[model samples]
Target: MHDQARHGGAYIRIHVTKQGFDPLTQRLRWSDLEQVLDTGPFPDEGPTTDDPILDGVSYSFQVTAPGRTGRHIVYAVWRAGHADQNYYMCSDVRFPGGAPDPTTPPPSPPAPNDGCTAAYTPPGQWTGVSRAR
Candidate 1:
């Protein structure tokens, strides 16, 4: 998403609903909203028009789907800092497995010092884009 030179950053709010999104009526009301997934006050990473897949700054989040195997609609709202205008989008996703067990704890992480060395070299520096491998 493009920031369009907004000031502070952006706030990202994500909601999910089991109800299907109507293409003709591309608007959602508060009653149609279901679960609130993520709300982020993230840093400004500039425009993603420059190959977002290669080196775009982003925030990763995990969401809990409602059921085991069904389709769901995820709605994302982007509110720019110090701005009243907001951008909205809807995405359809299908789940293959049953719901996760909330009682089960997540797996442990790997050790910090696992005998790994770090080395990186940038391919080239563009006029306004910078990246590290």
Candidate 2:
């Protein structure tokens, strides 16, 4: 990702590779891309893949980032040529911290809780079953 600190904007570069025969030159279309910050959704208008994408080449396009420092999610989708095959990618990025370390394991799940609670019970029929206690 290219950090445009001066312009207060950023861009992401994607490298695509194909194993088999290369397809004819076709326009690359970006279906959708969304950035969700801690505050709310941040929208960005990126470039279209009009350039001929040769095998094993990199493509870069402008992207938007949140101003505040916090974890963010970027959802992106694109399609090549006129094929029905659609490519989808999601990225979990953090401002000021950058991307998470791949070596580190993901955080564990939160502890489970029962659905029923004292607040849900009637006033007269107190179960006296305080889960906290």
Candidate 3:
């Protein structure tokens, strides 16, 4: 998993493979992403194939919290085209006051949560739609 930050907030841009880069930090940033989701518990459950997904396309993702009262969570599952570079790793994501307990997820999305800054999900079960950059 990879990460990127913006708007004075911290978020993770998980990539199935290292593709993009952040010019400043000089790190492999996320890019060409297609879909993203919050997988934690109940409101933020996880590892379910039922989770919505984009097709075999190169996708980019990131997690961010713009203010102090913000909580954080793990933004997982990244797809990088049809190439299978499945390496496993994790991010040391932190939030407002202090880093949240790793055992628990920050919170569910739409709760002041920043959704995918990219992608276009059209009406009626958005299955095979491509978002413009």
Q: Which candidate is the best by TM-score?
A: 1
For model 3, state the Cα shift of residue 85 in Å: 3.9
User: CA lDDT, every prediction?
Assistant: 0.60, 0.37, 0.33
Residue-wise lDDT of candidate 3 within 1-133, one digit each (tens)?
2211111112223323222222223333445222234322111112233323521222233544344222323235432222432233444333446433457543433435466477766675568666768
Q: Weakest 10 consecutive residues, lDDT, candidate 1?
A: 18-27
Number of clashing pairs per prediction, in order? 0, 1, 9
Supply candidate 1's per-residue lDDT for 74.
72
Q: For each candidate, what TM-score against the reference?
A: 0.46, 0.32, 0.21
If ranked by lDDT, best first, what sequence of candidates would result? 1, 2, 3
Candidate 1 residue runs with Cα over 4 Å from true position: 1-10, 19-29, 46-56, 97-133
Model 3: runs farther than 4 Å from truth? Answer: 1-62, 65-76, 99-133
Error of 1 at 60 (Å): 2.5
Please give the lDDT score for candidate 2.
0.37
Question: Taking the tens digit of each residue's C-alpha lDDT, what string does model 2 give over 7-77?
Answer: 11232223222111111222222332223322121223233334444222334555545353434445554
Candidate 1 residue-wise lDDT, 69-99, digit = tens: 5445678888766667678878866566534
Question: Residue 27 in model 3: shift from native, Å?
Answer: 27
State candidate 3's TM-score: 0.21
Cα error of candidate 3 at position 131, Å: 78
